[model samples]
Target: MATSESANSVSQVPENCRAPNNPILKLAFKILCIIAVSRESLDHWKDTKNKDWKEHVSIMVNRFQNTNVTAGLVLATTTLFLSSPPPVEHLMAYNSTISYIIAMISFDAALLSVISGSAVLVIYETSTAHKDMETLKHMPRYQVIALLLWLAWPSICLSVATCFLFVAIFIACFGSDNIVVNIITILACVAFLSNGALTLYVFAVVGKKPANGKKNTPTQVIDMHHASIGAACLPR
Candidate 1:
């Protein structure tokens, strides 16, 4: 007991004798942590060979969050107003049911986008990843478009649509209303086809990597700041 008291007093005394606090020191500590994290991330990119692949996925995680926010605010407003359908066939099986199911599917997509983006963005934003990309003029717009097209593709998800519930919703809404279903289906098909074609064009344009060490002029897509950090931290 005596030895323990002596040791505690000696060890604890140093802490008790320190100055009240220093704001500058606290800020410096915070900055140091940031720098260390940045350094780690920078090294990570340098080691990878598939720089474009990395960039592609990074942007993907990004768009998810962005589109999610937009969808939430815009679609939610639309849905609220849509509660009062036109005077004719309000709650009946045709238009109302079909439209409702489609609305639900759209809502579900927004949610999934948010979840996917938030999960990755959290890693990119909170961690040292930001440390590396402090400066970059532009990102390859073509690649970004390609990525968006890929993400939009339903084939990758394997099933007819995204998850099972999405498929069910699609089926529920698809055949209910002759006019509404036909119009919506045509619009959706056109959109999918157009976007897919655009993606293919981008790929053809960016057919091969530049032979020499050259990066094309970046066309800013999302946050230039975040993209810059990702680019910088990209390992050699």
Candidate 2:
């Protein structure tokens, strides 16, 4: 009798744990289960990779973290400088239209750099907080953030060039023909051209993959049991 009662209790456990009959809730539960299982599988694979290639993995992770922090600081400084309001005399030197346009472009570029820098910092912090296995699960998202951050630098450069263009126009229009002003205008033009060229170079080179000498891919572990359980729990 006791054995039968224990068996009945065990049978009811699955029923108790089952999702509601509502289709939406069932679907949501299934999705959540799949995601959880997927994360587990990824974590297991990460662990395996760390075990098999600890030194290489550590070097790569450290490189990424250092790069992120360095890039974030540079971008944050640039953003702060660009976002600050110019002096009254500087603003008065340019026409209203040119001033407004430069201001808007600078603001937009600054905002983008801030966001990019913030994302990189966040990814670096999060990666550092997690253990090796846990960090691997987030690498894809971090890569995407890094790509956006790289693009933001070029955008900032372009904006800087635009600001310099307006400065050149301002110097050309109302300024005296003094040698000092002429030299400044020439420098501004050179800066604009340099920035434009650098922007083009960045866009061209950003897509190339680093020449990491390793040919062996990391071994991945798939949790078939967890996947099967998740599939079984899903609604027909």
Candidate 3:
């Protein structure tokens, strides 16, 4: 519990939920995923181990099967195209197409993960704080802010990637083999680089557990918690 509006003391917690070092880290990490890789797959991976996954076995099973099946299709199609040798087969020999498909599908899963993960984290916090829904809702609005960020950030990133891909596609359409349909290729690289950097920044700030419950001093910790769920932490 908050001991007072003091700096040295620590805030109280319930018995569950893992804490990170800096509260702001989660927010940064969330954004990084959007820019870095298939946000959907990452989120799906996390969802695989969550409570709902266990409770809703049929839904979870179907989702997993479908995802793998889609991935398999890309692989099978590529193999078929590559086994023969010819003018058409030369394009098939380049495996980047399959890689690109995988990346695109993965992005779908990643988006879902970003949304679900943020929700889970905020709900967990409310539970840990032992506050009711209304009380928790007013506390820091973690879920609300996360939802907003989830909407906007992807649009910005997608716009950049899509615009670039469009240019590349137009060039390829003109019979310039060099352009190619490599949307996934470009996206995969961008996602990995941008998100990886974001993850590192978050780790540096939060380290392991979130800051010792900053229930005092302008409520920095609480705001940080909002930031953790994928919102901007600073006023900027």
Q: Give the TM-score of candidate 3.
A: 0.26
Ranking of models by TM-score: 1, 2, 3
When summed lDDT is taken over every stretch of 10 residues in candidate 3, the lowest stretch is 9-18
* TM-score for predicted model 2 compared with the true structure: 0.34
lDDT of 2 by residue, 132-193 (tens): 54443345544533433453343344445445445535543335445566576678778877
lDDT of each: 0.44, 0.47, 0.41
Judge candidate 1 against the unseen true structure and give its global Cα lDDT, from 0 to 1.
0.44
lDDT for residue 198 in candidate 2, whole number 0-100? 100
Give per-residue CA lDDT, model 1, range 75-145, as digits (tens).
46434434554433422232355556655555555455455445545654553354443111122434423
Distance from true location, Cα of 189 in model 1, Å: 4.5
Using lDDT as the measure, the top candidate is 2
Candidate 3 deviant stretches above 4 angstroms = 1-16, 19-24, 28-55, 86-236
Error of 1 at 34 (Å): 27
